[model samples]
Target: MRDLDETDVEILSLLATDARRPFSEIGERVGLSGPAVSDRVTRLEETGVIEGFTVDVDRTKLRGGVPVMVDVDLAVDAGADSDSEPLEAARERLRDANPVEHVFITAEGDLRFYARVEGRTVREWLSGTFEGVPVDDWTVTLVDEVEWTPSIDGVEFALTCAECSNTVDSEGETARIDGEVYHFCCSSCLSRFRDRYQRLEEGA
Candidate 1:
């Protein structure tokens, strides 16, 4: 993989602010030619640093309801009943629930969802959504406004080894095998991964 530098970081920050910002404008700000900025962006995309650009739509204007953030704690005996849906299955169902703009899973395994809901029917919506989900308790908060600002300030970027999930650093290695790129923290892990992959392929 290509090593990221200060210029790359600045490019990312600029793009994060406005994905449609022209390359010439970005070049003027970053002291590079437009083609140089485009090349760097293409490389960033190839290295997976830049996922696809997205559009930010104001759902509140379209949905015409009060926006709310709901956090749900899973019950200890969640999905214990034989006839009840499994915990993951129930979570998947909630994720696919209508009108939910965003869903997040906290480190502690709690579920949080953002949606626009009718103020009076908030309770009804909660009960209906969590009826099949194994929820212990939940809290709903009214969101007055939403602001999204992505920055690379004070951030260190590193890729994880495809085999052992370790951070790849300057001393690490990257290989292209089977027409795809993979990173490794050490050569031994890379060899092991390749051998296991070969064995699996032969067995198949």
Candidate 2:
């Protein structure tokens, strides 16, 4: 991994809080010009420091109550002797599943792959979509609580509201509400923040 400098870390920190925040605003906060901030962000993206910008959607507000994390163990074909070949095949099949949010290949344990599923029920997530797929064993981990912290270069990011300048911390994994970014300490806070932000957006 490439080492990140102080300015790079600060840029990552700010972007994590609100991906949509203009480069000018980020530059103001970090004491750089808009173009300079833009250049840094571009470099980070190219170097893989900033992977991609994504909006965190609220699952509960949609159809599902809460998303479940599923660990799937696949029974590979005996003909496939090499580990890399089997693993790649498993990943390709799993990627076809619509409910699968993320998939990871592991090396240290008996379980070779893990995935996060978002659906109305665990059965629908597993049996309905992944029934015919060859799998030896599977495990489902329902996330009851999550506490997320934004860190860059071994330091936590400082969060502040764009409107109020209130300090905030990662309550959990982020979820998008409409189109704006909001930070919450918990699910309750998330709901409240969404409502307030929506109202503000409407008024403007």
Off by more than 4 A, model 1: 1-63, 78-87, 150-204
Please, what is the whole-model Cα lDDT of each candidate in the order they appear? 0.67, 0.58
Residue 169 lDDT in candidate 1:
52
Q: What would the per-residue lDDT of candidate 1 be over residues 108-156, giving only the tens digit for each residue?
A: 6667877767777988988887786667778999987775432378575
Show the lowest summed lDDT stretch of 10 residues, model 1: 55-64
Judging by TM-score against the true structure, name the best candidate: 1
Q: How far out, in Å, is residue 137 in model 2?
A: 2.1
Q: Per-residue lDDT of 1-204 in model 2, one digit per residue for the tens?
A: 355555665566567668899999989977899999999888777765566675333334322245566676767677866555545555666556534434565564333333334444666656655566566767877776555466899898866544334456533323445543444333334444667877998999
Deviation of model 1 at 87, angstroms: 4.6
- What residue pairs are clashing in model 2? 56-175, 56-176
Clashing pairs in 1: none
